[model samples]
Structure formats: structure tokens, C-alpha cells
Target: MEKEFVVIGLGRFGGSIVRELNKLDIDVMAIDSDEARVNEYADIATHAVIADSTDETVLKSLGIRNFDHVVVAIGDNIQASILTTLILKDLGVAKVTAKAQNDYHAKVLDKIGADTVIHPERDMGRRLAHKLSNSSIMDYLELADEHSIVEIIAGPKLEGMSLLDLDLRANYGLNIIAIKRNGHITVSPDPGEYIQRGDILIVIGHDNDLGRFESKLEDN
Candidate 1:
């Protein structure tokens, strides 16, 4: 079956998701209480409706439960977003992702059973800091409280070895999840994939191990 997604609050975050999902060929239903906002995504989503999601009857009428994923991106109106998430959870929506306005809002969403809660602004800030602090880090993502995935530009030390020779998992306890060469990405690269000077390694491991790897790379 084709995946179906519901985007609540047709604001920037929700609207962006709707457009991107449509580009991926996924079915998207965009919902917003604001008629103008709903109309904006009408050409991008499979369906766009102006209806207050905080109203349980309205949510039910939208067949929200049929959606495989629902994203709550309501801004300003925390009560409505929280209420909508609660209703979606109670209705057994398979997955619910919510955008938090602040720490308190995030906590409330967590308590109400939001499967994933994101602070896009805060995350972007952290990512920018990570990039600025380390010249070698191309990108970074916090996967969990104690784990992260980072893409680091390969330096001089790794220019001559094949992935098999590096044996990151056995030697450094890190996983080379992907490699960015030139402008292309090689996902789950083969053991024989040779490393070049300009390659960027997308590695995932414990935070401590990643730190150790970065330190070692810098020294080399």
C-alpha cells in the first residue's frame, strides 16, 4: 500500500513536509484551520482542507486514523496542537510527529504520546554550532541522548586505505554508514570501497566513540 501522511497546521513546517512528501510520491493530506494557509498547499498535496484539528469530530471526519503518519506543526496555538495530538493518539494513528514551541510544549507532547517530537529551530542551532566548532565535520545529527551520526571530511590519514582496512567497527567501534564522494553519496558502501582524500564519511556510533574518532583524525 502507498504510504499516506497527514500534515496538521499548514504553517511553514507542515507545508514544507507536505510539499516534500508529494515530491517523494507519497500521498499527503494537508489540514489547517486557516483558509488561506490551506489554499496555499492545495496544489501541492493530494488533499488540502481548512478544518480545526482540535475538534475531535472534525478530525474523525477527515479519516485521520487511515493515515500512516501524522505531523503536528501548529505554531502559536499550543493548546490546539496538544489537543490534536492527544486525539490522534487516542484514535490510534500509527505514528505522530509533533513540533514543539518550547520545552514545556515538548514535555506536554511527550506526555500525550507523540511518537516523535522535534524542535527544529533548536536542532538547527545545535547543528550549526557543531559545524562551526569542528571544521572537519560536514554534518551532524543527534540520534539519541548518547548517540550521534556525523559526516566528517576524510583527512590525510584515511586517503590510502580501503574500508576493509579501516575496519571501523572492530577498531574504533564506529560504523561508516555512507560515503559522500564528489557530489554523490554511496550508501552502505562495500568493504572494498577505497577511501580517497576528499571523501566525506557518514559515521554512526556512541558519542564517546565518535569524539575519540574525531580526535584521532585531527591528530593524524
Candidate 2:
């Protein structure tokens, strides 16, 4: 089935999604109150409209509920963002993704039926802090409720140790989602597979548990 996406703001974040969706040949409608921004994506998106997304009448006229996904990317204007998301949900949009300005906005959006709330800047700051503070941690993805996925390099302490030896699940409540070694990726590697120095361990677990595991690796 073909998916249709409607982006409600044409700022950097929303515009990028629109352009990428166009590249993938997906149907995307770009909506912005600013005529200039709408014109910018007119040639790129499947459809570009100058409409006030906060206005329920405008959205209904556009048949926004018909789209498979709706992105509420309104920048700065928290009121408009909340209103638009509420209207989208009320109109029965199957999926509503909203960009939040801060934690408060995220909470409100979540409470108002936004299927997903993205607080990109704050999330990126946390990710960068983890990477900078822990050289072994190459990447981090924030998940709900203080959980995350992290990619950490296997240190000397873990050299030649197999997954069973680590017992990460029992000890740290972590699951090794994958292991990357020597440019080869192993998914759900057997417990008996030996870990080599510099192997990247992709792990998913609670944030505190992950921190403890990383600290233990650093200690040894």
C-alpha cells in the first residue's frame, strides 16, 4: 500500500522530511501558513499547500484524515502545534507525529493523542553528551522511559569473552541486539560466539543499567 505523508510545517526539520519523502517517491503534502515556505517545496513535494493547519476547517477541506501519516512540525508556536495535533487526532488521522519544543510540549502532545512526539534537539544533546563522555560509546538512541540502545566498543576486559560469559541480561538487564566486528555484522549472535577486541556491541536496556555496564567495562 502506498503511504501518504502530510507535513504541517516547512522549517528545516519538516522540509527535510518532505524532500526525502519525495526522493523515495512517496506521496507527501507540504503545508505551511507562509506562502514563501510552501512555494519552496512546491516543486519537491507531491502537493504543497498554503493552509493554516490550526484551522480545523482548512484541514478538513484538505481531507487531511485521508493521509496515512500526519507530521505536526510547527516551529515555535506551541499553541498552534497543540491545536493542529488535537484536530488531526479528532479528525481520525491514522498516525500523528508531532515535533515538540520542549519536555512540556512533548507531554502535552502525548496527552492529546499524538502517536509519536519528537524532541529532536534535546534528544540529540543527550546523545552527543553520551558519545563525548564515553569514548567507547559510538552512538545512542533514546527510547521511552529512560531506556535506550547504545553501540559500544568491546574493550580489553571483554576480549575473548562470549555472550554467555557476559550474562548481560542477568547482570545488567541488557540484551545484546547485535555485534559488529571487522566490518561484519552479526545479529542475535549465538551465546558461544567469542567477543574480540574493538567489536561493537549494540545493546538495548534501561539507561541506568546501561550506564552500570559501561562503567564496569571501563573499570576492567
lDDT of each: 0.91, 0.94
Candidate no. 2 TM-score: 0.94
Tens digits of lDDT, candidate 1, 1-220: 8889999988778888998999899989999989999889889999999998988899899899999999999987999989999999999999999999999999999999999999988888878887887778888898868799998998788898999999999988999999999899999999999999989999999989988887777773
- lDDT score for residue 113 of model 1: 99
Q: Write the per-residue lDDT of candidate 2 for residues 1-220, one digit (tens) a residue.
A: 9989999999998999999999899999999999999999999999999999989999999999999999999987999999999999999999999999998999999999999999988899999999988879999999998999999998788898989999899999999999999899999999999999999999999999999987886673
Please report the candidate that would top lDDT against the real structure: 2
Per-prediction TM-score, please?
0.85, 0.94
Write down the worst ten-residue block by lDDT for model 1: 211-220
Q: State the displacement of the C-alpha of residue 84, model 1, in Å, after optimal TM-score superposition.
A: 0.8
TM-score of 1: 0.85
The lDDT of model 2 is 0.94
Q: Count the backbone clashes (under 3 Å) in each candidate.
A: 0, 0
